[model samples]
Target: MRVHLFSLSFLAVCSTSVANLLGPVYPAPRDLSSKSSRVAAGWKALTGRLHSETSSGSSLLKNLTFSVGLFSIHDSAAESLQFHYTSSEIQNAPNGTRKVDGDSIYRVASLSKLFTVFAAMRELNSEQWERPLTEVIPAFAEYVKSRANADSVYSTPWDQITPSALAAQISGVARDVLPWDGGDLLLQYAIAILAGLNPVPAAVDPATYGLPPVDLNDALSLSPCLANVSEPCTGPLYAGGAANDAPVYLPWTSPAYSNNGFILLGLALANLTGKSLDEIYKQSIFDPLDMHSSYSAVPGASEFPRSVIAGDFTSGFGYDGGISKSSGGIYSTTNDLAKFGTAILNSTLLPPVTTRRWMKPVSHTADLQYSVGRPWEIYRYKHAESGVVTDLYTKLGDAGNYGSFLVLIPDFDAGFSIIGASALATRSNATSLLADLVTESILPALMEQAASEAKKNFVGKYTSDRLNTSLALDVSPSGNPGLSVTSWVSNGTDLMPLLGILLGNENSRLVPTIVSQGTGQVAFRAYTATQEKSGGLFQRNFDVNDWIVVGSGGYATKSLAEFVFEVDVQGKASRVELPACNVTLHR
Candidate 1:
């Protein structure tokens, strides 16, 4: 919602007025193909260049396995595209003999968090979001009770952490605890062997010989995973390991990444749903979206035909994240990732309001351009043409040789996904560059097309039968951010001046809220441009009101600036309802 009441602007701030537009000048709503072709060509060129350089054995990303694809909620008419490159070395591997394509699967490391949060959103209610982790998981509750009454560096206050906190990376727990590599012990063995000494010592008690001392957090002690070469920690060892984690920051003090936080959340979800995390994801997300190639656990031998083997084919290619799967272990293809992104963007499984609430930032970082959602890394993209900020909900995964990125642009009901694998440090850079290229080359065109489409359908003169009381709206032909109100009259009196305090020199625009108002009706919230005179000397909000008063006037709705437009079959508005003014104007 907009902090400032929606206002209007003139030609000085945006593109030319509607008089020069309204024809074949701008891209039609469904005519988004030319840009897509150019974007596809750009991606193909990048990968093709890398492949050529790799064949010559001179490229920095010589072994990089890369793929990217665009998706849309409206896919039937959408000109979606995919591009990929795989080395012949990989194609000849045992399990990777199959060529890479839309169905080819790679480990989507941290992107699994998106599925975890989606499961939580589907199974848990609003009240459960704030419920403490201690209250949900008995093992974790026991561990917290084992800690002394004081909060210190040795122990985290898990009782104060909630699913919301964990999902938002604000739980204040240690980032990770399992896979505590035992390199020192191996080094000692190496030194003993070099000196012609026996590296193998006589066996001691089985309970005390091979693992760390049996302490509160020695859950890994029951298993050999501390070698960091085994399957992920699960069961008591997983719970105990997480319980022993130290405090990194107090809850909500800062945004800190915590894999164990997600691990704990998986345990809590299992406790609440009476199902394993694997089952939960499969039933709630994967199966429902028809994501045939997606899996929370390792695929069986039959599924190996589609797996992308990056390295250490025996163990690493099909590594099971086990309890930590919710954090960084799942596998998917461009095809499946596209379906998943579409489901979230369209609210296919969840209600529109729930999706809206889920999409918002739970906490913001120090970086102005970045924010955090439940599992979303939101990047604020400002269209240079209209100066409107669009939040691109994204999730990026990086674990060992595997990397993935899922980006959703709600404004255009469009998004894209990228997944790649490489031992080189450049793997992350390659995926990031894919996102930047698409946003730079295609997003501006999409946004401009949206403005033009809205102008053709919604902008016009509307008046009541009472005469002299009318509304006129026009969008900038070049690129206004939203539908600008050129005129508004009520009961023979001009009310734009009355709302000037919130409107601010006529600079607000109506942007879609996606708030459903029955069929053929759409909702829009008002946003007025406000600036500060601090000259970058201070950190502050430029809004005109406090957060406390938000929605208190309309009880969860923007009362002052909400406009409901009754549209027809072709999406042209016939009338607009101004609830704040208790008036309806007809066209």
Candidate 2:
């Protein structure tokens, strides 16, 4: 890896012991005396590793400030830890040192979307979760139609988008439809200003950067709109001619990350609540959580202390953070974020049932390593040494110059939030390194906690002669509450790889973990379904709809397929019915 070491002139005196520099880990009142010592050791080890890794040239983790909060819903006990570090003087900010307590604010880009989504969800009811875009904010849908070519297919499809689908990044909008994901033109200007590079003349004009230049002195007082809109600013990438671009596909055909989706969702939220996005957030989430230091960057109205990007203290236009209204315009501190995350986990912010919906996998990547939730990313994080595969729900934010990550492991009753402010190009990768450390050093500390009973019934060998398939279910005791299954056809062939193309392959094995549709009887449910198809004359050419009978190319209009297992009088599995393949097998 090559380090694009842009010349930076920054100097600061930093000399402190690791223990002194990393402050105390806030523990639950009852366990404070005992838990503090245990948590300190892990914090020290994790920060020490991060500090050492920053010595590398290409590593984006030159400096980091973070907080970790551990809490259990069963017991009201909760704790938090804060750590700050400066790797080397080479990439450090001139005005600010790596020393940050819980209160130091950093610009957290996409992480802002989490707060926006949460606030928006709070204003909606169960039925509104699936409400169409046309109903939520028909005006925005009309705007989308006006920008597209008169005959474009996207104009009509815009009405079909749902708020929940947009939150999950499955709205079928082009990633740059509203182009809130940092415009290239704006980035060019930001890079020049931050890195002291040669100015790209193209970025200085309204036609170039998408929005008019921010008169530095006047930016704080002026409420500038992007184009003709009355909102503070929507980046030029999606403004004017940019909106004319065709969409990737019709709604929900597949998943594609869209900043525009979130932007539109934010507008819909305002329409629903009859309040500005920032106001809706403050009243519902920030104030209730006592996160005093958190604020959404909305033009001149709400500006919090922000770290400098490149060599300059930034505001207005795409300086510190990009000019995104609801997408990535938030500045918050470690302490506040820790509280926010803990509150969500404890159901203090949203009800437990709704919180679970936030983590549920709405859409998954092709490899299945990661799943997209409403505004969260869910995945199994495996610690190498402990070999503990735990489910990690995470939301990552990268504001060009700074990176932020909030991770939660509900099973372990703990989570960590890291905020890094730096000018390194690889700042986005900083969160991954810290997340890995949290999984390795911090999660194991909570090992004494008990596992869910759902695991016991799920681990067994299931086979069906008629269906010609066999399943070996094993207990990943350290993993989330679900059985891990290795599936095979009766011919001893792995059915996983072939299902990849047929089903968009989120994950291979079939694990009927959740119980569904039965009383006084043992039942199970699986997230996906699989069916067989062939390309030969007597067989079909594997129609896209063959495997999963749900979602875009499916036979049904649902997200997950249900599977039910029949158990004998002894509560032992006797046989199973696979819905996707329409087959019955004996255990």
Candidate 3:
């Protein structure tokens, strides 16, 4: 049982156990003594906690089934890990399985939007992004007109809503067209009323609402409002009396998580492509990616399938035969998803340039507390104590009983996915907690691997005895793509007096470009002005073109002052000599 084996708090605790990346020590390999070993040990400790006998009983997370999937690309070496677990009793299980692996299928709610957006992008042009929803669905157009004379509260600018805005989740549509029950019944009436079209009702049980007709054209003929209901379309599905909760802003004015917008976008795709959402995905992506285990609708998936688990509180968890399907109807395994991720990252699915644009930030709030890409999410993970920041392109899915995460970090050339399900009502936060573990553990290790490879040549500590100063070279992949030298008091003893005489206060640190690889000319930008007294008069000193040059065992100062290095047989600098200043720095 993998119950609560990775708790949120425990993940936080395990974060500190990894080797300090900023220090001299390198990240350990995946072997027994490496960082991977620490992760495995952490997992083991948590597993023990999961199975520990408590006054209450066994842990809830240990009582449910779950799975984890990972793939790492560092220095071009690829590695993968996949495992799953289930409770001792089968009936209490969410997916009703004892174990799962990369190939095992599970419902990945909301992640379906990524596929839908991709499918739409392949066929739709830039202009289609802002194309009106009513233009694609004429019935929705009729609904707009019907509400023209009604209160201003229930209407939207039918002409301004676009698939792009909706995909970005900036469209002002309600979060859901209706609550679950209202949504289910609305799909029911939509099928009957849209007479000629085949509509997949929201109801999971076919007996609850028999399969409607298969005429897409006929269904397109239904009015937004039904004649049987004399009142204006209201409640969860329609325009009733104007209320305080009605959307006040138009599309793109703000950000809202609108499933209704996605559903409408799906309809627009069908309308524009003259293909069902199912056919669109099958033809555009699944086939191309070779995701055979993936399904829009699982076969004989009972009201609940062991393969397509739903939350304990969630009502429906099956194919998105209707509107919500485009928003949450995907069922896939980690292996299949990795293939999809590989396609996006490698630009096999779309052109490299276009895919890059797709991942760019599409929506962000003032405080940056909320932000998202076209269909993906942008996340920033900052180490609380060290301030090491990592950027991630990610997507999250939670279908009540099931929760999942798919992440990509281009910086590390690595990505991973986590999918798990639980029938235990107490395990609601399991998925997110596991996501934290992945974030706190896996990512930092991979980043360290990449950094170690990139910095093996020139990163070291250099000390100047005369100046009593120590300089630590940190090579970062950030702006300017170079190294930064930070000055520190040698041996933690304050040496401001020595530093003040040899180097200007402003010259304590240097950020310079790497003019050549293999320890070649490192140039530091030098300041020409000496100092400004209280009079605000700046005294000119060094030449305007002055710059520092670091070379083979020798360096030139801003004033063309030359310093030579004393090197060992390996050509590594052992000491740096500034003849003009009578200073020698030991490395």
Candidate 4:
């Protein structure tokens, strides 16, 4: 049997308008303040603990060998405060130790899965979730077949995996397993084994099976395999290794790394959206929320930076198609990450209902503290004062060897991200320290401020021509926005029957775009092919106080278009116009 691997270079052709038509731009505050001294004190205390745990000696906060940067934001109706910090001693090898800024970039492994989950959710909201994975990614079928046994009981169609399931790691379609090393030939050997061509014993100790030392070349070469092997073959998890027989696939020479499950997800998302993962992310989330410093690829595209966190290697890794690129490929500053946390907690991007679904704890298995949002973990935090335990929605990422930590804390409307490289494993203490600081000093000060401004600013319908989607904004009883496309509609009358088929109980976010606006005749555009160049514009009929399409002459192009409406302010939307191609705006 011949196996054909899809070339990683195959680029998806996505129309630029997919993002533009989805919605308008949503901006976040650029800077934070320090008006609340109490909050600042708390932050100081927390940061002190973080340093105590991670820094070398009690004095001067030195002995830290890795590069580190930290930032926190507190929001409120009255004022907003922000704090920034960077370690002076630690240095990046190639770049040397430099003063890290809020915008400095670092690899944020596994965290990239969040973008994948969001892309999958977008497809679900568009009612395209049921489309076979083969339709979006033909190569996926091959992986599915090689990974699963014919007799395996968990045999659901690959396309049947919902966005929610993928986010929660419940899809059970296992190919990307944990613990990777550089071993190129082992991948080919593994692939051969999965294809039933290699006659190697079903059970062999990976350490004893003539496996080469774990390294990058070996990881890229390992063929895709199911998480489970044949029955009774359980042993220690088989970290990828290399074979010595083939000189062509050398660990040190090859540019590919295999540990990236998320990169595959990026490919899948790009194929499904007809655009690159980076473009989709910028359009769907980054541009809207104004996360300027965040990006999927490394700087300059020529030389990817080394991971600052220790335990992860520097030379054996390359960004091209490695596991780190997809599973944990994001490089961003602490300031940008903090903004992401605020946007999620404040419902600035996704609708309230959808946000709730993302934060909902779907899995409660004891081994797993919480499950719902794609990359986020549901963990419980004990209130320091009350001794009461409360569920906290969080996500964490470690570049493994790089010694970087990315964390998001939704319940507190606060988050912190740290990047550094230490000679010792204990260097991860920097992450713990930052997390502690946010929980203690930063969040409380920011919560009241976030609550006050959020209550007033985010309660209404927002439409965007760029994305061709609409969002209805509303506040939850807990003061968070209940953003979801599942509850959205076109105006108050048009019900989207397709939503029932596409999402059913699954939650989604409504993307929208503006057509045109005027004092008397405000018009809006929806989803339509003809109006691709000119986002559909609607003008208000002065006499009826209702919105009406500004005629073809009135529009830059007289083409039929589709439009969506957000009703009930749920942050979800339904297609409202197809034939009419226009909508009336009302305050």
Q: Which is the leading candidate under lDDT?
A: 1
Going through the candidates in order, what is the number of backbone clashes in each?
3, 1, 17, 85
List candidate 3 segments past 4 Å from native: 1-60, 73-79, 89-96, 146-151, 179-248, 300-321, 457-482, 485-587
Clashes of 1: 3
Worst 10 residues of 2 by lDDT: 16-25
Model 2, residue 348: what's the lDDT?
82
**Tens-digit lDDT track of model 2 for 46-148:** 7687667656665556543344344443333344555665444313545443445667666677788788788877788767777776666645455566655
Q: Candidates sorted by lDDT, descending order? A: 1, 2, 3, 4
- Stretches of candidate 1 off by over 4 Å are 1-63, 92-94, 126-128, 180-232, 463-471, 477-480, 486-508, 525-528, 531-563, 578-587
Instruction: State the C-alpha lDDT per candidate.
Output: 0.68, 0.54, 0.54, 0.42
Cα lDDT of model 1 by residue, 533-587, tens digit = 3333334343312222322234235376667888775567889887776778897
How well does model 4 score by local distance difference test?
0.42
**lDDT tens readout by residue for model 4, 80-110:** 2233334443344445324444455555555
Q: Which order, best to worst by TM-score?
A: 1, 3, 2, 4
Q: How well does candidate 1 score on lDDT at residue 150?
A: 55
